[model samples]
Target chain A: MPMMLDRRSVLCGGLSALSLAALNAPALAQATRLRMIWWGSQERADRTNKAIAAFKTAKPDITIAGEFAGWSDYWPRLATQVAGRNAPDIIQMDYRYIFEYARRGALAPLDDYLGKGLTIDDFGKPNIESGRIDGKLFGINLGVNSSVVLYDKAAWEKTGVTPPSMGQTWEEFAENTIAFGKKKPKPGYFATADASGLEPSFENYLRQNNKALFSADGQLGYEPADVAAWFKMWQDIRKSGGCVPADVQALDQQNIESNALTTGKAATAFAHSNQFVGYQALNKSKLSLTAYPRVGKSSPSGHYLKPSMLMSVSATSTNPKGAVDFINFLVAKPEGVDLLGVERGVPASTAMRDQLTTKLDDVSKAMVEYIAAITPEVGPLPINPPQGAGELAFVLTRVSQEVAFGRITPEEGGERMVTEAKRTLARK
Target chain B: MALHSEILSKEGRASALRSRGTFRRILERNAAGYIFLLPWLLGFFGLTLGPALASLYLSFTNYDLLQSPDWVGAANYVRILSDDPKFGAAMRVTFTYVVLSVPLKLAFALAVAMAFNRGIKGLTLYRAIFYLPSLLGSSVAIAVLWRQLFASDGLVNMALWQIFGFEGPSWISNPDYALYTLVLLSVWQFGSPMIIFLAGLRQIPTDMYEAAEMDGAGKARQFFKITLPLLTPVIFFNAVIQTIEAFKAFTPAFIISEGTGGPINSTLFYTLYLYQEAFGFFRMGYASALAWILVIIISLFTAFSFLGARYWVHYDE
Candidate 1:
């Protein structure tokens, strides 16, 4: 019996050793395998994969693995990966999150790699500076974009109502939209999506009003009265049937495919300028983009050239050099830039932007043109949103819906929003 | 006889030499079974119990995923109970769901189960068909499909318009109807409990029904007096399980609402809210506190159910 036990123990030990060996074999064979993750639609993924293939062709010795998820799933997935210390080598970052991730020490500082591997001479000083947090460069600006009203030009033409122009006041825009709705071009169609809940739209409105979403110290920059006024404006528009019904607008989910314009429920949608390409692809009508309406005729432009998204190397990455090299190629290399059009917004590099302008399709060209058009009018970028700002975005959406559904008065909704927003910001 | 005495004396000497001989002998006899259970045992410790204990510790701290945990000592629990409006909303939603979905799902399951127990032909085929929804109901794909089906211009609203000249508000988007749509989805997936009820129905002797018939009892009378009373134990079992599942329902609400639990937080299930807190807001400590509260609530409910079983659940005794 002792002899049998010895034999069994030896067998088990050998099998375990062999299995462990099998797992390690692949790592040994691969010279430098890097993992990159991003969140986007299939279009962005396709362009990114193409660029990756291009990179692999350039650097055959360094193999790369790519992963992607939709917008909502991406952050949570990345957070869990970071928490487990198993983050990908390369990460596609968002403007709202870069500050948080960088401050938390999840991202490697790119200042050391700037000119060595990451050549951004043509990327422009301010464009590169946009990724700086706490005086340290944490992310590479992938593209630049701002809030815009995307509409179906053909649909608006059919309604015989002049569509919103770039410099129109909010009141004028509302009146024009209401006029379109009064035309009754379609039985169920409204003039625009309800943008009262959208964080960007709200932030843009704040900018026009000389207030911002968050003060520099990360508190509510605007008062509850401002929020009440914002909600009241939307309520007026909604009452006039100038925007899609609250229930119909609720289905948008802030995605291109679910957009009121794309779904034919509304003629226009409030979204980022970069989404123009994706929206046009989905809608039968030819979609067009314009800057969000101003608060008044002489109001400062709420539009700012925000880094649509950024690419950062994870602090836990084994090969930070390899990650930085890929980001440079993606941003600066002509062939790499050509592979990825303006789907991630217009290229941050002037050289890449110039090269791709002629090569891009009509829809992509429009996005580039729109950004260029808004450049002079755009204000300075607002401070990075506070840690709890993301949660507050949802709060705004909920309170907006409450107001829209007549469950709460605009004033009550405003008070609730301010209180909840303060509570969220104060949680930590 | 002399050899047997020598063997007994040797065994006694071995037992005297090893004080733990009885325990070692028991282990040695079951060594193969224990080896076979090693994988499950490792998983139970490493994956389940380890994380559970970690969460329990985390519940007492202020641990964002990116930062090291700070000892806060019941601050998270206090905040959840006292200050969090979303917590209250989530509780209301979950309790409403459990109270409505559990009994309704059970009753639907029992009805379908009793209908099938009438000894119909192709019973296996019918059972399989009815059971398909339960297999697929909790999945993201099914939830997405549910979203489309309940959209304002979806197939349901189209049918409503065609049949009754009525326009239905978006069932998946309207606050008033969104949770009910989820509840309806829950009711539709009654296949598993129905299968259990079918088996329990099979356990009851047909002679009881025959005796009831001889006593001039009608079908309704017999079902109420015999079938229902006999099925109480199974119903209790199903009730406990379904209530737990309803409390933990997250995927459908998450998917249908695009993970916002929206149309004014109408579909904010307790678990969904916990996930949002943990992941969306990066409030891991608070989420852990929420999870502990859920565990306590579920345990209390289950305990009360067992205590209440004495009054309702019947047994042969």
Candidate 2:
């Protein structure tokens, strides 16, 4: 009887011990949640998710939440968030917006983090410098980009027109466009698409003319005649039936997929060479890249290498170390390069670029080769324009519209631009 | 003798106190009613009245939202009126859009309402079908869809090629045709007016129609003499509201033109230009001036509408 009673007590104690262990299991485990924000398409999202899973495997204690949007909505939303003083720890930034946000004290400088094992030597110095503002590193460039003219190979063959070779003059370009238009003179179909408004395209022109949009002193750069000539060229293109009309250019900017070149209505379009990856998904026709047209003096300084976007850490971030680690991975890690592909531009790291090429499809390989072939006299990327720069963009649009509507001559429009630009610069 | 005098004085005081108590009760009841209205009164004071006054004050200053405002009295207004050419162009475009679109939309609404009022079968189905456009009309998705439909190689051009053997112009992209396309889009979503007209039609007395029928009046004649007069109040209401909405239109311009009001600024509406200044240009003071101008213009137009309504709008005695 005594033996049986002792056995029953042991069994009861064992069951109670098991229950206690079960109750304490959750207390031993940790919970950590992190949020990340970016702007990109479904493919980019998928690759990012894969990288997030890999990150989770390395650090099982951490959890990541992601938010994303298209390019248009992303910056405005991010700006509002920053103004509200509640931004995400890590943000995917565009090159245009890097300086603006950094100057506003929204982004954290990465010098300290670099001292603590976060250098991007794997990425080249020129690529890394693209994200600096006032000598402080504010962003990490994932790749490089330059303007290239993308032409439809099939359409060029049909029209019996040769694509513009590297260093082609504006005269040859106009002649080819007119010839292509004559071959296929259908409504809504033209030889060439609209030129880019300001940004890289305008800067390209200024550099070719041995001028800049802003002087070394950061004031209005060019004479009014330069703008007048640019407007005259567009007007001539529209009048000669070598390009889509003003109205069509308006629609092209609205829905990029509906642009004349994308719909096979035009022979060529202007875009970053890196954009070929994005276009490959949208167009069924094969696209090939050529250098931007030569103008004025046509020196190597006319063209430039630019970072398409940068990844930056937020000033308000609680996980500055983790953020820097992620940026370093984006720039230095082979796996991160594989995930990003050429979406950010050509890989900044030589080894990463070499490794990525064997696995990359036709478009990325071509972009790498195109960028490599250029002479190294590329000018330093321009700083983000001042506060009233947005007004200048709108004013340019208005001036162009007035010229197109015949409300004003191109010369008058040029004068209007100069006046507005001065006013905008004064506000700055 | 002293006891009698004291009792008489006490009785007189009590009667006077009763009258005072009754007066106090009336005051308390009045206070209760005001207490019931306090929430809405507070909302008006806090949200609407405060912002309206602030916007008015802001119009006289150079405010960029990021820094303290500086007083620059009348400069913003003067620049908009005289120096800014785009401002004048935007005004002209907005006026043209409002004048053309409002009347066409109303006529379409009235016609559609009349057809539905004929005791047709599947009335609910038809109403739902007509109402779908109004529900989705102002959405960015609809504007994007419109861009595709009216694009250079869109369905409209495709059908034109098959039927007419001639290509159509890019309707939404063309500066000459873009405003007309917007007018057409506004006309397409006439469901709200049609619904209001339907209700007004129901309120019309059947006896009047019966009397007209007995007098050998035709359907069109009865519509003019009886239905038209009865529906005037509803039509007037819809017109004022729609005119206000037309003057403030922004989404279509933003989405269809990608914020350039493009194709040579043919689609540049007034509100869009204001947005460009406020957010794009960081000219808060200038935008505030523009807002006040819009408010004044809308008020004048509304006043004109009410003044004209005396000639046309009819009310039952």
Candidate 3:
């Protein structure tokens, strides 16, 4: 056996090393291989890989390897890879993260490639602009989405109360919720989630008053009084039983299956437009989407279509050109968008998106229609959230949870938010 | 006499050279053995020691993953000790989890082990059945199952309502109950130490128990006299192992809380918080400092356990 091993090593090992040397030689370089990564459910991964397979067929030499993980695991792994200078050639980005990465020079600029190897003619102007940072296109918005409130249609019908409309004021929403909440058998369910601890609601509320979550200088944009009033509104809603009690509702925040709408603890819950289908899958109730409670009289509805998810090239990519080519194919190729459909969000290609509408499943079509109705009213997208904007949601969640628990008043919560946001945003 | 001593010294030098030659011969003969140990040795140095020392250096720097680390001296430690409420909360949660889990797990393990030691039928099959949990309990599937089982309208609550005629809280999400549910899950996987206890039980000779019973001692007295004294070492071993494991608990809490350590951070184990700082917030330097602090805390507990062991452990038995 030892003699055989010696013979094998002598015979194959030297040849193997020779082959490896050949692989490393610049003259013998093979395909421009790229590693692309994203985080989502199995459906997104499946659709993404399918698009990739088609891209492989179109540009056979520019090969792409797909990698993915669930949301929480993806960031840490991606960060480690970036730190180690082994980041994937391309990564799926988020609105909150685009600035952090693009500003830090972790992502590559795609501005030069646009209209040359890549085309954005079919990709809408606002959608294309959403990915630009300081005039450099660091990412391509995969799809456009806006936040919406999802309601259990059957539950609303049973409540015997007049339901809310698309542009209902906060007061009107509260009154309608209380009427439903006061029905016999205690309604068993809340009218909606507490939503005090949710950042999107806070952002939209501030935006309704023409304020952003962060100023151009990266400071807290809204006045403390504005947030205080927002908190007080939720507090009033809770007092009227228009939502679940703070503690119970706090348990359901950001947890999909345990969310009040899915758990039968609420008739309505606030979620992204894309989440309506997911909520329906988890619950037996027939679900429908409506605009988030707006100012009713305001011209700008404080909602804007932002990239639900974005795609970016890593700064360390060896094959930047191929990476851009692959991304262009994913974004603009008819076959690619056709395979991806409305899974990520509403597709940016109006022609392809309109084509998808004809073949869409009921839930997906509803999401597309919901965004279409709200698009005209949405104000311009705010300065693509700030560098530490990803952390803002968590900080807001923590501070507002304190308010929900009654450990601090709304004013105090607002003050704490300012301090936390400043500290975090200062890191940028 | 000097000449004789010189001769002896020369002989000794010759023998020393011969011994050194023999040592080299032994090394040559044992090359295969060394090759077999290579993987473990490499892992010990590369995966364990390398990262540990690197983290010690990293703890002194601001190492956000995207950017290169900048030296911050003692800033991370000072911040953790002074103004970080989340750190305090994480420490409290960890201690509560560790303190509650280790003892309860051992107690459950000991009781089940004693029952199994009572000459029960199908011992091998029963042993395997009971040991299954320890093998599978730490898995992601089990954690997901735990989340579903503890939901407000889930199987556990439904069973309680049906059997006891009382409503149950959402055990997984309720802040007051969340940590304890994790504790219960930990206690449920007491199979490993139970197996160790079973082995310890087998070692105690039946003659000792028979002698105690013949002397008019009751069954309880026999257990106290012969069984308990001999079982101390196993108990000590199990306690130390379980305590260390408990301090490092992460996966279950991470899965159950869906990675945010939420329901108001009630389920945030120290490791989970360390993970959040390192990964979630991208504050690796603070996380490294937190990790070193955890090591010190665990070592102190271990030292205390050893000191206390002198009082109750009877190894001579």
> Largest TM-score belongs to which candidate?
1
The segments of candidate 2 whose C-alpha lies over 4 angstroms from its true place after superposition are A1-34, A59-62, A122-125, A185-188, A196-199, A254-256, A296-298, A375-377, A401-408, B1-83, B158-166, B210-221, B282-289
User: Once superposed on the true structure, which residue ranges of model 3 sit more than 4 Å away at CA?
Assistant: A1-28, A121-125, A184-187, A245-258, A280-285, A349-362, A405-412, A426-428, B1-30, B214-216
Kindly list the per-residue Cα lDDT of model 1 for residues A55-113, writing each as its tens digit.
Answer: 99999868889999999899899999999989999999999888889988999999998
Taken over the whole model, the C-alpha lDDT of each candidate is 0.91, 0.77, 0.83
Q: How does candidate 3 score on lDDT?
A: 0.83
Q: List the residue pairs that clash in candidate 1.
A: none
For residues B72-174, what per-residue lDDT tens digits would candidate 1 score against the true structure?
Answer: 9999988888888889999999999899999999999999999999999999999999999999999999999999999999999999999999999988999
The DockQ values of the predictions, listed in order, are 0.77, 0.31, 0.38
Instruction: Order the numbered candidates by lDDT, best leading.
Output: 1, 3, 2
How high is the DockQ of candidate 3? 0.38
User: Residue B53 of model 2: what lDDT?
Assistant: 87
Model 1 compared with the native: what TM-score? 0.94
